[model samples]
Target: MADDIVFDLLHSEIINYALEQTKTTNGSKEVDLSVVEYIGFAAGYKIMERLTREWPRFKDELDTMKFICTDFWTCIYKKQIDNLRTNHQGVYVLQDNAFRFLTNFSNGHQYLEYAPRYVAYTCGLIRGGLANLCINSIVTAEVQSMPSCKFHIHVQRT
Candidate 1:
């Protein structure tokens, strides 16, 4: 419990600092977000590895992706995803009406512009988690407002 809190603090600080540095150095939000996503990727990969040890071996790629969207999402956010949609062709959308991390902030309109930073970290987490399952994919985050976020996962064609 205590460790989780500490890690959360550390994660927030690290992402913020990284974002600032990337913005100042390259002035690119995409790059800054990618750096943040990399952080998530590292964490997701490890967490998924550990999780796989206890979970049943998946027979379908879609099932594995759902596990990440539901079980993994809950583990990180304390709640399951609100909605999940898939095209059955490797495109998935996970929507969280009250994303836990974003819910903590009470920022008004100005916050929308900065929402991507937080969303990027989450996008990275999803991508990293999927990658560990041998499903190479790209994750992008869209925030319509505070506490509401959509994560788009596109599985790569190989």
Candidate 2:
């Protein structure tokens, strides 16, 4: 349905545009971040459009921002991966039970060394892009023990 349209638009249309952007910068061979960052920005831009459309008169107040970030991590992203957590801070645990149910999905064969850094990069992609839309935030990740993935994210309202 709607997902089909978005998939076509992103893959068929937006993907070509992203490729052209890479070529203009000369193949992204010397600079790896070029390609990844391009995809990140494009995806981020599209997401922002959807966010604005869904919430017309967006007010980036503290409580409102908290709700949006929590909803994004817990509901949208968590569904795609098993055992995702959106817990922030200590004691209060402001958001005890978060993330509504959705289709379960798993990450692909993630590399051994990069599993944690990869997660951190994703967090930055989402957080940094959102900041472009006047939503100030920060993201960090950590994977301590090998094979066992552990990711931590710290987000603040601004």
Candidate 3:
């Protein structure tokens, strides 16, 4: 519980600060999202380094990604991912019905506007995790409402 709170606080502050900085710099939502994602990417790389040091090596690309969906997501959010789907063609979707960072987010009118920031951060985290495992991929996040987010991952088929 304490860790969860700290994570929430730090995530919120980072996102808010990034948005503010982006506004002053490029004033583009896309730019802000990129900035946040970059931060997540760095974090994801560090996390993967720490988590994988003692774990068994991944068997394949899918296994590494599955680790992100299950182990990585759980470690950060304190909950397993709600759903994982793949076409076995390098495309994957991981859904979380109650994503931690957005659980208490309730901006009502600004919900649509503000939700993307958090989602983008998550996308970066997933992308970074995959990248750390040597899987080049594009990850994206979409939200239908607060605490409900879907992450889409696309790995380059080797």
Candidate 4:
């Protein structure tokens, strides 16, 4: 319990530091979270390598997504995805009723404007994790309410 709180605090601080660094460097009104996302991407790619070291090779794309929805999400967020939807056409949506990052904020839409900054890293994390698995994807997030968030994964077939 205490460890979780510490982790959350550290995560929040990292995001805040990244935002501060971006503001200082760019000196512009636009908030570019690409740096944060890229950091997440790199972290995800490396973490995935370690996480899957002892696991068997995935049989298909669906299997890989399952790993993300279950093991990967759980490993990082400490909870399994609440819902996962797919269109059989290379699109997958993973919903979390209580996203770890957002859960610390209000449950209402008070902080809606800042949700993007919070989710950017996670979006990159998902993308990076998939990339490490040899699956090219564009990961995006939709936050309707504060704590609940949905991540959309578009698998690129090339």
Candidate 5:
């Protein structure tokens, strides 16, 4: 309980710090969260290295995605993804009905505009984790409403 709150607070502070750095560096109204995302990417890559050290090799792409939706997510957010959808064509969607970061605030559309900032890190986290596993992908988050966020992963087949 208390640990979750502390984690949430730290995450919020990190986002705000990244946003401020971006604004200062760009010197304009433009919002660039690449730095924040990259931070997540590095973290995710390293974490994945540790997490998978003892695990068996994944059989397929779907197996990898399942690991992300369950173990990876649980390690970071303390909850397994609520749902995962795929087209079986190199695209996957991971949904969390009560996204940890967003749940700290309103449950509705009150902070919808700022949802992207909260999710940018997570987007990169997913991408980096996949990259570490040798899966090239672009991860993005969609927030149609508050507290519930969907992450779309597009695998780039080369």
Candidate 6:
């Protein structure tokens, strides 16, 4: 029911924001890569909303989050972004857009001028909205960091 509540909202907002972002910066860029990534973030943010509603204890652990991310990946992203629209015999289409949106966000963002910091900031944005309604605290850890980057995400108590 909640999925029905949020899917179209997430879908439209992400596409609209992606289009606005592309127009503001890349100047008429298509929704090839970056838009997909942005959509992933927005969709992930939404999915986290409904998901935690079912699994109440899912929070504040690196490995648990990784597992959730993995499921989210396989069920949503891997077939599309990792496989990139191949007609590979074994893959199935994701039932929704979560994969296209987040996978792109994770990968495409790596090329930004300040990739690590931007991601931390991104985590903040995602958390700012969902922390109270669904989540308690966000725990994000960058896979890599630079001396210039002061970003780190760790567990926070509710």
- Which TM-score value belongs to model 2? 0.42
Candidate 1 lDDT tens digits, 1-158: 67667756776798879978887998765645667778888988888888778898898987887787678987888788888899999899999988766776744455787777677778888888888889999888888767788988899997
Give the number of the best model, judged by TM-score: 5
Model 6 scores a C-alpha lDDT of: 0.40
lDDT (Cα, tens digit) per residue for candidate 3, span 45-121 = 77888988887978987787778877788788888899989999989989888888777766333476678877777
Count the clashes in each prediction. Answer: 0, 0, 0, 0, 0, 7
Off by over 4 Å in 5: none
- lDDT by residue (23-49, candidate 4, tens digit) is 899898788888889989999999998
- Tens-digit per-residue lDDT, 1-158, candidate 6: 45643743565465566557777886764433344444445656666655556554645344343434345434432432122221233222212223332333455435444343233333443344244334444434233322122212333443
| Model 4 TM-score, 2 decimals | 0.95
Superposed by TM-score, candidate 6 places the C-alpha of residue 44 at a distance from the truth, in angstroms, of 3.4
lDDT of each: 0.81, 0.43, 0.80, 0.91, 0.91, 0.40
User: What C-alpha lDDT, on a 0 to 100 scale, does residue 104 get in candidate 1?
Assistant: 67
Candidate 6 Cα errors over 4 Å, as ranges? 1-42, 49-66, 79-112, 117-135, 139-152
User: Against the true structure, what is each candidate's TM-score?
Assistant: 0.87, 0.42, 0.89, 0.95, 0.96, 0.32
CA shift at 13, candidate 6, in angstroms? 13
Model 1, position 156, has a per-residue lDDT of 96
Tell me the deviation in Å of residue 74 in model 3: 1.3
Q: What TM-score quantifies how close candidate 1 is to the native fold?
A: 0.87
